[model samples]
Target chain A: MSILINKDTRVICQGITGKVGMFHTKGCLEYGTQMVGGVTPGKGGTTVEGLPVFDTVAEAVEQTGCDATMIFVPPAFTADAILEAVDAGLKTVIAITEGVPALDMVYVYEVVKRTGVNLVGPNCPGVITPEECKIGIMPGYIHKKGPVGVMSRSGTLTYEAVWQLSNLGLGQSTCVGLGGDPIVGTSFIDLFKMYQADDDTEAILMMGEIGGTAEEEAAAFVKQHVTKPVAAFIAGRTAPPGKRMGHAGAIISGGKGTATEKVAALEDAGIEVANGPADMGAALQRAMKRGR
Target chain B: MKVHEYQAKQILRDAGVAVPEGIVAKTPADAAAAFDKLGGSIAVVKAQIHAGGRGKGTLKEHPDQRGVQLVRSREEAEQVAARLIGNTLVTIQTGPEGKVVNQVLVEAGCNIARELYLGIVLDRSAAKPVVMASSEGGVEIEKVAEETPELIFKEHFTPDRGLDDFQVRKLCSKLNLAGASVSSAMRFMKGLCRVYSELDCSMAEINPLVVTADGELMALDAKISFDDNAIFRHPQLKELRDRTEEDPYELRAGDAGLSYVKLEGNIGCLVNGAGLAMSTMDLIKLHGGEPANFLDVGGGANVQQVTEAFRILLDDKNVKAVLVNIFGGIMRCTTIANALLEAYKSVGFNVPLVVRLEGTEVEQGRKIIADSDVDIITAEGLTDAAKKVVAAATGATA
Candidate 1:
């Protein structure tokens, strides 16, 4: 019943030999995810944390029968890694790499669409379906197994929202970090539709920021097709204009992509908008109450 | 990452767009040369920087033989250039910090009928470059958007597909089609899109495109920003980067290969994950401590990024303390400790450093830093780390 991933998803690690990749792969294994094998370009046949390594994602996929890849390669190579995964016919990919250029991501997007493969992030925190399967750098202990599905573009905002929701006993069925890059592989609309179809997911907590029309488009999408209740928060309401803050997409360009605009759009779609990031959990609770 | 107006236009022109003739100047001599290049009768002398307020300060001039006039100068353009050559121009548009002018753009002034703002960038939701057109061009499209949003039309175009002719014509008509200038604007838009896509730009904008008194659409102002991550591919962009305009610490941090974007804050943020770094920035603000910068050494940071992050924290001069928040995940705390020691070795610090460590080998990480010769303090949790950093910044006893 979980959204994008469950316990049975076969996972392969790209850049499994890298320090960060190896650490997180071990973490995924500790969480009891099916860490089948890994691909490290030149370090084929090596073992990292007891997982077999192959040269390419295709080799790892062919040898291990893994179709889901979590990429931890550096920025310059992440786009290639994504393309490799998609070309290998991977069904789902979660790229843990940040600082990927928008140009690189645009190509990755074209490849994903061309290959019909789903890519999660270029700046995201990765996805975790609570106790079912964890595939990111989030604190596993803070997340609890539950029914609400959380999707966010910003990492800290996502973390803050999840921490608040977890503390309030409103655990997430899956919390997907869509990444905060100006260009991302998945939008809120994509995740919203998935959450809407997951029967185990009762409500949604979507965290958006002041950059891009992703939230606006998602709001428009929800107004038409999304049946489940959505509670959302758009960050940087009071943030200074034109400054990127942290995320590449968090800029207030030419006065558009403001928090006010996103919230207004989300509210107009009949979804409840939280007052701020701090109230996201309670906002979800209220939306759940009203929807029921 | 934003390039100046004349540069954007020149890039547009090089890309085969019909843009007004312009020249870049670095000094009064260069401005005078540019003035001569534009036939010296009438030309626009503007300060070249990364912001949007040349109309206000000594940044703009029309130097003539008489003296320096902001709008009607021929000689005063020299004074404008002289005054701005080695000076800084502070504007609300440039954020809390202002941009330094090492160059000035001198161009043939345009006759105006209509002014508009047009920009192309990656659409946040659609994940493609979206072109935005506004009739209220020059002053601030944000104000235009706030007061009148319908006038703003966003045309989404994929990079691989390039610009659509129909969309370009449609946009030109909205910018107000009267003459063949509609074609000129369309040409400029498409050219800009080409440069945008080819350059791997994060944003490219032309604000206040004036329909000159001569019935010609002219881009009076331009701004261009390249994706910093992509700058490595283009050596020309790397050369164009004015590190002098950035925080010395931030520049140094970048040199250290860390992702650090300076912010207007007092609390220094050091985090492992970019998402966590963002959350730390927000939390710092929520807790009443402005983050000095968004520093993400990225996951699996080693000694170099950690120490560079620390040195960057100290370099902020405004920062009174440092908040090292690392959620180790698979990254061991011991590595964090080694990094702290390494950073301390590279740059000795006197300010308070708060280390918040969690995950595998957490105690080992703590032990490494605690055992280091460098003074290090531990936080009970992230919130506690934040509070401590705030306390240290404000000289409080919390």
Candidate 2:
């Protein structure tokens, strides 16, 4: 019933021997993510946490038959690692690594589109399907198996929303962080489509910010396609124009990509916009009740 | 990551693009010498600052002084440079405070001709680099794109594959260029595109790409910014970063591996991840408190980085209280808690402190804060943390 991954989905870790890779891989494994193997170039034939290791993604895929991969490579080599994963025919690749060059993502985005492999994030907090599996760096304790689908463009911000949703007793069917970069592998439209098709996901909660036209474009898609009830929160309402708040991509340029504009677009599409950060849960609860 | 006009022109010229001969000078004597060296009977003295609209900008100290001046003699160049070098130039782009001009660009002025706009930007929607050209130039391209959309033309280029000849030719036709000027313009645009890709530039703008009186193609002005993520690939390009033009606190924070932006408020926020930091600031403002700065310790920040972030926040005089919100993802709550105590011991914290720790090892993190001798107020959740921090800030200020 999960979108991209479940308990049975075998996973391969890229750059598994590195500090961050090892730490998060351990975390994911502890959450029962079905870790089969990992890849770390020269450190092949070594085991970090009782899993087999190989030199390249192809070798890891061949040895373990893993369909999904968790990339924890450094920012400089993340683009090449993603292309390698796609070339190896991995069905899903979730990159927890941040700061991949925007130009590199341009090429990776094209290749992934042609290959049909679902790429979640280059600067994101990977994906989680509650108690079944977790592929990102997010803490596993806050999630519970339920009906709502959560998606966001931030890491810790996503955690905050999920924590609030959990407190409100609206456990998530799945949560995905799309990453807060100028360019991302996954968009709100893509996640919305998946959520609409999944029967377990009765409602969707999106956390967006001011930056690119992705939110606007997603609003257009939701109006035309998505049938599920959707509640949204757009951050940076008070952010001054033209200043990049904290995210590299979250800047209002040429008088476009403002918070007010995004909120208006979402509202125009018949989606309910949360009044503020603390009001998201209440708004989504109302939307879910109204959907049926 | 944006470079001044003189620097942008140098990069463009290196890639074989046609640009006016220019030299950067720090003093009026240097500018006069450069004008004479360029065989100048007529030259342009331009104040070098990051913001655009310098041509129409006026000096802050002397209202009558302009940023860009056309001088016919060496003495005129010296006089203009002297007026601009030590003065502040206020432009439409630069705020009311404006930017201090430290250098002047002296170049051989071009003959009368038609001005056209040329630029390459990484279009997020297309997921590709796009080339934009318009018949209107020497003015804001944004205004033109908004007012007369059809006047601007665009061609998308794949990152793996660069711009082709036909794409450039098609763009030239859209500019209404014909004859030898068309071919020359095509070459110039293509060269600029090459520089854009090779340099890993996020934006490469040649505003007022002019066609000379004698049918020559020349780039009259250049504004370029490189992708910060891709800066590691190009070490030589890193040298072009103008530190003086940047905020000193932000620069120091960057060096310490913390993403920090100075804001005018009483509450200083230190959080993990950019999105969380922003939301934290929003929450503070919503709770009737203003955030003094936005500081993201990042996902993998260690004890040293955390200590530095604390010091930076404490250094701000307006900050009456500090809010530390950490969600243990790649980073653990216990690690951050230890760093907080260490920072307090070394740098000392005189301001009211509100700390909220969640996620992995929350019990141990809370225990560490409880055990510490330093005065700290712990919150149960985000809402509690925001309310407590706002109250502490107000209480202190009141």
Model 1 has an lDDT value of 0.77
Question: How many Å off is the CA of B270 in candidate 1?
Answer: 2.8
Q: lDDT per prediction? A: 0.77, 0.89
Could you give me the TM-score of model 2 versus the true structure? Answer: 0.97
Find the candidate with the highest TM-score and give its number. Answer: 2
Summarize candidate 2's per-residue lDDT along B323-361 as a digit string, tens digits. 999988878899999999998788888989999999878
- lDDT score of residue A74 within candidate 1: 91
Cα lDDT tens digits, model 2, A151-250, are: 9999888898888889999999999999887778888999999999999999999999988888999999999999999999888776677778778778
TM-score of candidate 1 chain A against the true chain A: 0.97
In the range B1-398, model 1's lDDT, one tens digit per residue, is 65556667777777786577777787788787777667746776677766666576432232221111233565766766777777666665655445667887777766678887888877655667889988777767767777888989889887777778888788777766656776776667777788888888888878776777766666667778888888777777666666666667656776777778777777788886555676667666766787787787865677767776787778777887888887665456788778777787778777787888765577777777666677777886556777778878788324
Best by lDDT: 2
Model 2 regions more than 4 Å off: none
